[model samples]
Target: MVYCGPLSKACLPCRRRKLRCDLRTDACTQCTRAQLTCSGYRDTTALRFRHETNAVQQRVTARKSTTTIPRSPPLSIYCQARDIFYHNYVFGPSKPFEFLLSVYSQTSKDVHLSRSVDAVALAYLNAQRPSGSAELEARRSYVSALQYTSRALQEPHLAKQDSTILAILLLDLYEKITTRAPAFHGAWATHLDGALALVKLRGDEQFIEPSIRGMLIRLSTNVLISCVTSRRPVLDDLVSLRHTIAAHSLTPPDPKWRESDLVIEFAKLRHNIDTRVLADENEVTFALIELDSKFLELSRQVPPTWQYVTIQVATKSIHHYESHHHIHPAEHVCQMWNTFRATRILLNELVRSRCMDRQGRVNAGSGFQGIHERATRAIKQMATDICASLPQYIHGPSTFDLTGSPSASSDLGSGTFPAGRPDPRYHLPCYRLIYPLFVAAQSSVVPPSLSKWVVDQLRFMADYHAIKNAMTVANLLESGQRTDVGKVYAMLGSYAFVC
Candidate 1:
């Protein structure tokens, strides 16, 4: 037999076993003779460290001498921006849903998605520093993202991918957080429209992956809420998705599922109420009544764990406040309850408004008055509950000195939350209450003092959280008050208030 060479390369199994490999082209000869499977040779091209000998040291020195030295540290702006976006927005305190981090990490390789992430991150950074170059960079990335997204959309194969859908969602968020103007408002709506269409195109396949399903559900909820708050008609495709979700309720219970189900039902009911009021559809009144009943049932069906349980303690207080009631639940649960109560108030108001006499005038009869009273009571209670659920920092004993401390409840009513470093409790995961707070503030039924407190909270959010929309809502509330628009809906006009 002709000698090939000395055995420098050995099969992995033989090398690990520290046995002679008898290097062969395919299976090693020794392994073959022993009837052992050969795992083939290890790759020698990969970079690795080894004990340095004289030869290695000399070679390394030679290479070091040949290579050029860098002048500055490597730039990681893109990585930094991505991390900021993920932590501050995707996993922020106000986000109620848990996004699968792996989904973003994996799909971040897509050009459109990466550009979108950069765009949003830059926009948020710009919000923190208004006169920065971040805005210019954000605009550039946004333009690039739009171009890539358009190109992706032109390709049927890429458009249906989850990454493209995620890119669209990010673009929508960018629009929302970047600026607050009448002109920019429709940009988000347009992105939302495209996202919903893509989700529809995916159909059941979207639900096959849990992460994708969650994303689609969130998108649907956003769209539904937008339509309701903007006084727009609910899309038929979204209604179909709602029906699908309702049918799947028999499946195992999930918090996300319950939330999506609740929001969809609420949207449908709100749309129906709006429709009935505008069209004077006497024929739709029965359907509206049925929807109201179903909404109540859905509220009851909210997972018991998600419900807020209030606790009352009798205390001999040294402070001036009369009531000493405290609600104990995760902030998100409290917010959900507030939303439920607010929606009920809206429903009641809508019904009362539609109950007109045959002369096409508002009914001031006993029935209308009773409903009006109930709606007023609901709005006041909702306002109280919203304030009660605020972080302890907003209405805690720490707000005043111990010598002659004011009651926490009084402190809340006065719109005085101590100003200093925020309490760690404020950093806790909680749903953003801006929408509910705005709703309560604009309710004619709520006392002006309580509404002022709500407005203060909105201003606090704008200053503290860098949420631009909070400032917008506060401005809207101020203008509404000045204009004597008694109802929040009246003040909103065609503009949608979304969280």
Candidate 2:
């Protein structure tokens, strides 16, 4: 066993456990009793990496400038989707969940910010100004953050004082400042505060850990806030019920709110609160759904047998934000969820043998493949659970539900959706939906063999539904763009694709 500065890699007995090597040695007395054979130490390499990475990172201090080094990871086709998600963490999607969740992991690498694969994060971040056309400004910031996140994933590093995920959180907060996704300014501000508070709990648990849970808390908080702004009483009630529903307190025979009341109250509130807030929340949810879908599609789309170019092209795609991560309130979040889950399974089963899922390691068929498999299983479970739970929020009279109404969707202006008053159920715990997905590999397990993700892709192929029309002409320009043409569209002429 080797002695590291403050951390020890392993004892003699532990070394043998590459297949459960009971790493124990005379140096590690406890390991010996356990019949373990501790072997060589390796944790030092990470520490050394941390020291050098920091000295290198010191060039951009938080106070001086929060700029990060940009990076484009070596993506296989399957992981190509990650390229977009990585950047989206920094710039796209009015609200970023996985991006925020991965914050703690940012410090370990340079690509999180300083580096750039395509000058995307830098271009977008530089575009951020305190005051500007609200929509355009927000879109700019979202684009920058997305690029930054992807680069970070590509270039893995370890910061001395912070965990990689924590760094990701802080960076996410920084990116959130750019979100104008309807009503997320307040949401971003509130989430930043919560993210800061999670540092103390970073080590207390194993399952998803408290810091991870704290991240989930911020996401859930964002969801609750969005519902409140959704101008939909039922959605609001669902938002409120989120935490309570978890306790099973809201599911009684009589329940806190019943169906007829749910319907009537939603109808009453449809003409009240400012639509901007509702529209914004609608937009935020849409971004999240898109992020989730993209993640599933890419994760699966990148075949284990996928070509390097396929992955490269996809990686480049992450840097390409076709437009703002905007979403329509009328879109259905649940409709495509199962399809995503099934697709994730199909893709993962094919590529499970490849992903590193860890930092600074080659994606080869080794012990890490097990972790990759776990990641896929995690996505499947998460998608399944989130989809199952989301309908509770939708079933209520919130404006998105057209089940019993005239025309199903009302064309209220920019923000209004069923323009209604606030209600109770809209506050349900929707954020709890993705909570356990990113836990330490130590605790995550493959679903019991019985759990299967079976979806009839054919079932989702129809009209395809409007779902979310987030792409704006500006997105078209920013995607591979140069000039801002109109207040709405960035560039009107030639595309990088054709060239």
Candidate 3:
């Protein structure tokens, strides 16, 4: 029998028997006859000493430190993932994440797919998923990977190789299902299949989990919002599932989070949905974005001033993914250029008419004057930063942030050439990105301040007259330019700052 009411200072069986006595975990001497899985009685005062601990351990252990696979990835894919991870930013995809997913689906399976220790197939599958045809392909690929992973887990003789592969697969699953990207049917279906397979994967009876099931639940909550935001499918079911997961997660080991990163992401997603969805009692969308950029404390309160939700989500998502599992170092230089171009488009497309006109008022604050100066400065900084992060062989400077990359690329986005290149004090990569971000970040009170900073930064770059080839940030500020950011942004170091 189970007791639901508050028990006085009663022993185990007394509470179990509905007659109050002492309190404990093991059975009290008096209630052996009650016959139950009796717990002991505890003093009320001891409740104040609340403490929590986790017994779950990190399952990954690199045996020889590195397990080398016979076949490697293409230069393009490697570079793209490396770049994005290093940069720590990405909004969307240049070629549509879906297109990338389609190509990856074909590339990673079959030859790459192994039921062994190699997991390039799983890694590739979880990395990108766009939509429709591409989504289908990606989903299929993920399912294949999951099956292979399960087969490894099922072996009565779980070898080191199998253990390594299975663990890696689980981590990849965790990242794939949890992280936000351009969602499509492919990723969703793949994830759902993986989830189901998780329950059955042992080929026998065994345990399976993704990241933490709790985190997965929280991530699914975000995925639901992703689907809703992207207008995908199953909104009602998705929501119901999230509630069910949350309710279950609150039991047992309970939902746990560290450093608050997961919570912050959840808050961001909730806010996105709150703004997009209509009134519903079960709505889990809402949160506050603190200014420190650390996503301090999240409140469940979602504001009505969410007109900018879509844009904010796009920008932040781009940044977040770009810096992680998305693009390569070489790819990033180009991506940075592309981002600048997007920034220009955003400004020009959104407010072109507001600021400028068929008449000529557009000239007033159209970034025509010395605005390019700021653009130039921003470009120089971004290029230098990009180069420093990459390896000398490919491209990248040496000063890349330590929290950067997975820590293994040798030669990447370094500005210096394997052939020949001028010193930084002389010529530099295109500096046009600065003007664009400035323009993007610009507000009524920010433009002039931005312009001043640009000028100051340019002054720091060196004499515009000395570096004949170097483009000034002010140049980007110019109203008229046929500059297509895609084409012109070939290399991070060869832009407005480059001559």
Could you say which candidate leads in lDDT? Answer: 1
- Candidate 1 regions with alpha-carbon error over 4 angstroms: 1-77, 88-100, 106-109, 128-131, 182-188, 242-293, 311-328, 355-366, 391-419, 423-431, 459-499
Clash counts for all predictions: 0, 100, 72
Ranking the candidates on lDDT from highest down gives 1, 3, 2
Candidate 3 segments whose C-alpha is farther than 4 A from its true place = 1-184, 187-397, 400-499
Instruction: Summarize candidate 1's per-residue lDDT along 387-458 as a digit string, tens digits.
Output: 655543243324323222345534333434435544333422221456566666777677777666666666
TM-score of 3: 0.26
TM-score for each candidate, following the candidate numbering? 0.66, 0.19, 0.26
Question: Candidate 2 — which residues are off by over 4 angstroms?
Answer: 1-209, 213-336, 340-400, 404-499
The CA lDDT of each predicted structure is 0.59, 0.33, 0.34
lDDT of 3 by residue, 1-499 (tens): 2223442566545665677554444566556665655566657555534443221222233433466657875555334433442222112221112122222232444322332112322233223322244334444555665675556545534422323233333334333433333323454445443433443333321212322343334334344433433434434444444444445553432112221223334434444444665334223211211211222221122122211111111121111212221222333243333333333232223222233346844345434333334334443443333322222111223222333442243222332213443233212222332334333323222344434444333432324222321234335433334443322222222221211
Q: 249, model 2: CA deviation in Å?
A: 20
Q: Give the TM-score of candidate 1.
A: 0.66
**2 or 3, which is superior by lDDT?**
3
* Winner by lDDT between candidate 2 and candidate 1: 1
Give the alpha carbon lDDT tens digit for every residue of 64-91 in model 2.
6755657877554223323443544434
